[model samples]
Target: MNKLPPEALEHVANYFRTLSEPTRLRVLNVLGTSELSVGEIAQLVDSSVANVSRHLAQMAQHGLVARESRGNSVYYRVADPTVNELCDLVCGSVARRFDQVVSAHAAFVASTAPARRRRAG
Candidate 1:
């Protein structure tokens, strides 16, 4: 198997590190839809503005997102459209897996439980 060069490996590692947090993922999800101000994203994600701003800053530094200032508001959006696609793909897969797990658990429970007779009038 081929291995990544040191610089490429470092870049990939940093990218994964940046995406390792829940808040960062949430921010990316929200930004994937459309551009929004920091306050708006914070509200949607139920995070403090300061915390959201910090996450945004980190993402912007990593080139995962881009920000533009309009008067007093700063709007942020996904830097690359592929990012939204990637997030959607991963999240959809997770949702499908969770659904399968729940279905299997329910089936197991139903099969193990004894059938109860209906009460006579």
Candidate 2:
């Protein structure tokens, strides 16, 4: 990225922007496991089929995922394996941070509980 030209940097930014949507992220999570039809994805994501189809189209346009046509139905799957790796890294980082936050909150509550109890007694 540091060596990328201005236009290349812009393109990279746009790529990240495409992954920034919640609905798209949810769709990706589903695709991470197995390829699924738009209706199946919509059911899992609790969205309408039309809405899921729109999300898939946007992601497919960005080459983040690919779709297969079977008869009249389409099944989407992760196209770029690197996207899965990127997602794994990001998700792992977030999960670790969340665990740290939860632990810190628990410790703070535990430390304060004794003080509050002492003050009451």
Top of the candidates by lDDT: 2
Q: Write down the lDDT that model 2 would get.
A: 0.92
lDDT per residue, candidate 1, 2-53, as tens digits? Answer: 5879899888789879988999999988777699999999999999999999
Model 1 segments beyond 4 Å from truth?
A: 115-121
TM-score of 1: 0.82
Residues 1-121 of candidate 2: C-alpha lDDT, one tens digit per residue: 7688999888888889999999999998887858899999999999999999998888988899999999998999999989989999999999999999999999999989999999999
Deviation of model 2 at 51, angstroms = 0.6
Where's the lowest-lDDT run of ten residues in candidate 2?
A: 26-35
TM-scores of all candidate predictions against the true structure: 0.82, 0.91
Off by over 4 Å in 2: none
